[model samples]
Target: MTASHILLVDDDVELTELLADYLTTEGLEISVANSAEQALALLAPPARFDLAVFDIMMPGMSGLELLQQVRPSNPIPVIMLTGKGGDIDRILGLEMGADDYLSKPCNPRELLARIRAVLRRMQTPPSAPDTRVIQHWGLALQLAKRTLLFRDTPLELTSAEFNVITQFMQNPGVVLSKAKLTERVLHRELTAYDRAIDVHVSRVRQKLSKVLPEQELIKTVRGEGYLFIGEE
Candidate 1:
């Protein structure tokens, strides 16, 4: 089995070295990039990475800007490292298509756990031998390919967004609470005031709305949660 390769981007040299050593000791391949520009270079061809850990605050091009640039062409799952109490940065990272996030000055063990969780969600189960397509309304979700289509036109979705919509489509008309979604999609328990699940759902809704104007496929049930309105 090939080890997962991670690109760690941060301006703190000592911190990056510490994480790289710790993650490497845990049987994962690590690549260190001290700046967003360096990270972009490493992200280019011939340097495939399973996941990327980027610090939200960086010199020159910020992590958010780097994410915006990378997301359009690359679907590599990203986990942002934000400063403690940096709620806005965390939310912005998710809106820009990040899979998960961690607060900087964090415990290496926690970061490792989050990394494993995100990678696990991105993996396809070997038990499913054939492609399974779930069609609802005009949307088609190809489980094997992990692609979503609207009226046969492909709808781009990040790894997190893909999982978010999959849960909704599979359980149409079912109200999935934030706690359930966080566990299912992110493979972690929901923390108080954590809005990662909400941001992911919002992104999916925004994408769906572009192709599904005048149709509200996913509905919010006020205090309950979100419900996917399937064809009755």
Candidate 2:
């Protein structure tokens, strides 16, 4: 098995070094970047990083800025490291297409768990039999390719957004609670005040709306959850 490669971008050299050593020992290939500029250089074409861990508060190019710059072309899963209680940063990171996030000064073990979860979500099982493309309301989700096409026009979605829409489309009209969606999409139990799932769902809606103006594909059920309104 080829070890998953990770790019760790943070201005905290000591922390990056420590994390690199720890994650390396845990069967991951780690590349440390002390700044966002360095991270970009490493992320250039031909670079194959399975995932990225970015610190949100770095000087110069903040992690959010870096994410904005990279997300347009790069689909690599990103996990943002935010300051403790930085709910705003957390939401912003997700809105900017980060796959997951963690509060800073966190346990390395927890980061590892998040990394593994994101990587798992990104993987397609070789022996899996479900390769059929899911088409609903003119939108086609190619399961095997992990791509979406609306009216034969491709939609660029982040990994997290793709997973969210997959859940919605797979169970159309089902009011999937935040807890359920979090479990399925994020591979974790939802915590109180956690808005990660909401942001991802919102992003999916926004993208779909661009190609689906005048139609609301996903409906928010107040006091409940969200439901994908499939073909009637």
Q: What is the C-alpha lDDT of each candidate?
A: 0.92, 0.92
Q: What is the lDDT of residue 120 in candidate 1?
A: 95
Best by TM-score: 1
Deviation in angstroms for 134 in model 1?
1.8
Q: Global lDDT for candidate 2?
A: 0.92
Tens digit of per-residue lDDT, candidate 1, span 1-232:
9999999999999999999999999999999999999999999997799999999899999999999999878989999999889999999999988999988798999999999999999888779544778888899999888889998899989888889999999999899998999999999999988889999999999999898888999999998889999888
Per-residue alpha-carbon lDDT of candidate 2 for residues 66-182, written as tens digits (9 for 90 to 100): 999998789899999998789999999898889999988979999999999999988987687578889888899998888899999989888888889999999997999999999
Q: What TM-score should be assigned to candidate 1?
A: 0.96
Native-structure RMSD, model 2: 1.3
State how far residue 66 of model 2 sits from its true place (Å): 1.4
How many clashes does the backbone of model 1 have?
0
Off by over 4 Å in 2: none
lDDT of 1 at 114: 98
